[model samples]
Target: MTGHVTKPGRALRRLLAPLAAHAILIAATAVMLLPLAWMVSTSLKQSGIGLSRGIEWLPWRDAWTNGKETVDVMVLGARVAPGDGGEAVEVGIKSLASRRRFTTVYVPEGAFEAEIEAWRIRPLTGEDETAEARWAPFASVRRRVAPEWGNYREALEKMRFWVCLANTLAITFLGTAGTILSCSLVAYGFARFRFPGNNVLFLVLLSSMMLPSVVTMIPVYLLFRELHWIDTLLPLFAPAWFSVNAFAVFLFRQYYMTLPFDLDDAAQIDGCSALGTYWRVLLPLSRPVMATVGIFCFTHYWLDFMGPLIYLNTSEKFTLALGLYTFKGAYTTQWHYLMAATLAVSLPCIVLFFAGQRFFVRGVVMSGLKA
Candidate 1:
């Protein structure tokens, strides 16, 4: 009887364990995703309203009806004052500056026409020296969800997004290709060839990874400047051709070592040279590692800011990462436009990661496991 009762309790605990773990994981995921959610929310919000006092998850705007037509308005403030018709309510129409009202209107107490004061501007005419301000009662004002989808369009235009995007894509594709080819060749040699000082050379290469990039930054800049590569994209993608990334080479070499030696022997028996064997047999079989390395290289090159900032002097040659910096001026930063452009720029990386996630995980796992 005790065994039977305990078995049921054990089964219940087993079920609850996974449930509790999943609940915790879901909560952690939500926490991690909160900033991204806020970015999306702020990107859609109207300007000047994004920094509201409270957390607003949705893009909401105030609309006011003046009994004739409804129009969007900015609510300044409200106050109560004495009037001929009972207690009167005073609402400010427009705000010219802090603690100052551009226009004011009076409304009777308990009147549906006057709850709060709000202001909207009319299109300026040639006869008008300034924009015409229209005021309405607070009772006619209603908060509604109105996402400013045009923020993306305006932001893109301001950032010269297409030009930056083209430059970024060019650098990313070229650099990614170079990294894969150069790293794979070097890794293959390290994995398959047996020569004196091979391990020592690889150790030296690995040790280079520990060195701070700042140590080489000035020397590299001088070298590129001498080569007349300054103010050009050459400095950005050119280093990939030399297999500068020790991590990518290490990944490829590990994956290569996991493959059987018999495959190399069979390829040799079939009259395939070392290069042919690598291109035909090993390279084809390294899809997972290739996808992993390609994604890493793509992201690095796509979002490289310091590289572009140092080498590319002209706005026409700017990458998306550097172009986003223009949204911040000496005085004010356009947070809405910045967030919108940031979200737009980050979409490709997010999509690429999700699409190649399976291969990326497989590559990392398989690279770690020895045959």
Candidate 2:
């Protein structure tokens, strides 16, 4: 009876240990999520104080009393051009009265441009222009109070968003698929076969991994130009098929090395060829490593701004990273629109990461066990 009671007590302790570990993990997870929460809070904040509408210009006050000089509002990027086009303009206001700055206020892109242009053409307007023109001083003061939702709409509409998104997806999918296939095959060869000069060849492949990415970028560009692959997705996807991912190959090789050789031997004994054995036996058990490789490939291509910027000359082929650049001006940037676009663009990556969270955790844990 005492032994039975002690056995149950031991089992309870084991269960409690994992429960305690999970509680600590939950706390760490919350800590990791704080910055993202703050970014979201700022994105949704209104532009001014006591605005009835849910949305306000920028979230904070304008102007600062640092007293160096009355700082003019600096527009980060304009969402829309003012006029009949009706795009929204992103505005930054520095209010001398409030002594703070407003970062992401929306004004009608058309309205902002029209306001500035109207000021430029003010002398030419006849007295009969309108009742508003007759009361120009009051109009000027009231101009700052209007909401500018059209600017946001206009900016969102102009940027071929769907097209850019499609291009990005195509590149990422093809790149990841090709890289995994080629890297896995090459890795299988290195792990299983004892060919002549195998060590030397692998050493060469490993050495290329140490080369700076910048050093080869120009050459890659030139080669792509010669092959007429630039400005298209071909240059982006084709490299992976040709075994460009040395690190991936190395990773796959390490994983394959730990696979039981008896399985390969058994397959051979059953009259299976090398390719058949690999395909039939080894691949079936390779899900963890494949998932690991997939995650890496997805992230690398998804966040690759420089590659798309250099190769994709047309707006139609632009990735999200390239499209985001449109919000920037020579002297200003539309922070509101930029922030909105940034949050929007980041959504896909976040979704993918969470969706694959289980596989990612499992694969990474299992992969290290072997290597």
User: What's the lDDT for residue 228 in model 2?
Assistant: 92
Candidates' C-alpha lDDT: 0.78, 0.66
Tens-place lDDT per residue, model 1, 1-371, is 99988998999999999999999999999999999999998888876644452588888776656688776655554567886556765755443123344446555545423322232222222322221222234445667788889889999988889999999999999999999999999999999999999999999987887889888999999999999999888999999999998878988898899999999999999999999999999999988788899988888998888888888889898899988875545214567788899998999999998998987676557546732
Cα lDDT tens digits for candidate 2, 144-260: 322334434544555556777788888889999999889988999999999999999999988898889999899889999999988888888889898899878888888888888
RMSD of 2: 13.7
Highest lDDT model number: 1
How far off is residue 173 in model 1, in Å?
Answer: 0.6
Off by over 4 Å in 2: 1-35, 45-156, 329-332, 358-371
User: Deviation in angstroms for 185 in model 1?
Assistant: 1.2
Q: Model 1, stretches more than 4 Å misplaced?
A: 1-15, 76-138, 362-371
